[model samples]
Target: MSAEEKKTRQMPKGGRKGGTIFPRIALQDAVGYARRLVSKTHTSRQPRDVIYSGVVGAKAGIGDVRISALKQYGFLDGDAKSGYTADELAKKIVAAPPEELPHLYGQAVLKPTVFKRLFDTFQSDTVTRAKLKQRAADLKVHPDETDTCVELYVASLATAGLVSVDGDRITHLASADMSETAAISVVTDENNQSLSNNSTVNSPATRIDAGSDTEAAASDIGEEDKNGFPVPPGNSAQPAPRANFNVNVTLDSSMDIEKLQKQLELLKRFGAI
Candidate 1:
């Protein structure tokens, strides 16, 4: 080869692979390693290669075929993405499966910064009682209902090693030096109390006037005349006999008490009581 051509060939391709070199394993083998790490029996961490070999061995066995294919299928579901780094794969093979990973990323590899941010948010923003209250309000749930949702979110974050709880306080996985605002924003302004109140006010239950029947019954009873006493007939034995008074007060006072009681009972049964 010419000197110029040889010099050009000597130059490394793709700028020397950019960062640290990571060993690659077959998709099936990677899955098996992950499963073994997650299995209850395997407590110690195993290398990625060792896990892959185990997966291959398991696949060859009749009963183990289903398990062997699990990791492979899971990766294929995400379009052949292993979703884990070499070190992470090794750790997973020794520790647990991606499915059992407590965080949102599961067994998938994440940048250290990203993982740190996620954990920080989980700790400061997620665990605080105030933050939880805000979240519940934003979700339109009563404060009483916040515990369950917060617990679930915390559990998920724990799996990912993003946050840890100590009594009431949550310790983030990331360094304390990280920005607190990012974490604070997560639980802020999530309260839906206003929306909930509006919904309640607009609901059919509250909108209905329950005492309407009572008001209507009261109105049905005719109003008394302007005088302090009830108007009397001009021919009746009264001191003040108004010549223009023609309405009979005796007929008005003859209301059926029994009928009124029966109507009230019916209204009570109909939830208008």
Candidate 2:
């Protein structure tokens, strides 16, 4: 291949064009935009009006970079001309259950900047700014812009509640506490194995006669007796024990009856009579 072609091919995805890569903003900014967008009092307005309304906790004048971040991360919708509104995702964020919020937040944050790459690079409790810079470098970002990417990532994560900031230290948060919802069902098998998403546990004794049991097939739940059911190895009700035995018999035509009698006597001796 030509050297020029090879060089172009080697360029990192979303690599820097001028001094830095594509614009990025803090996580808090996106969260603020989301909060305002879903509030009952919120109305559709130009991006500038929303930013300056002081709902998102922006102390300084809102800039294009901040507005751009909201659009890129899917919090805001529309262009500079026709005005902006809350995107569908923002609505979901407001309505999503508390347990589901973390995953939703993760999806929102990973949409922009070096945050996604830096998030993947994190293998432990904390990720350093130096490490984030290295990730930016890998993305072919300019040395001057690496710090910008790192700062954006750190602030964004802190806003997302995925990490805690202590001066320079960035510590990742434990996974959000998730609980089962109406959309999801968890079940345990006879062996105490857990399954989710309406999964079923196969019963060893209950044979599912599919073609014959059409009515049973209509329901998702397993058929159970009104009282109770035995799992396996029979129920606790005491019953007489039974044994299976195999016996070999030999007969001769000449002395069949006498030989049969002798064999029967031997069977009695062996407790098989």
TM per candidate comes to: 0.23, 0.47
| Clash count, one per candidate | 14, 1
Q: At residue 17, give the lDDT of candidate 2.
A: 60
TM-score of 2: 0.47
Tell me each candidate's RMSD, in Å, in order: 20.7, 17.1
Give the Cα-based TM-score of candidate 1 against the true structure. Answer: 0.23
Give each model's whole-structure lDDT.
Answer: 0.41, 0.61
Off by over 4 Å in 1: 1-130, 136-145, 175-273
User: For residues 1-273, what per-residue lDDT tens digits would candidate 2 score against the true structure?
Assistant: 888988777655773266544446676667766777667225665554555454444534445566677766778777657766777778878887675566567668777655665666663468667866887888777777888777877776666666677877788654332123212312322223343432544543333643356664444223343433211223437532333597876656777796577667645543564
Q: Model 2: which residue pairs collide?
A: 27-156
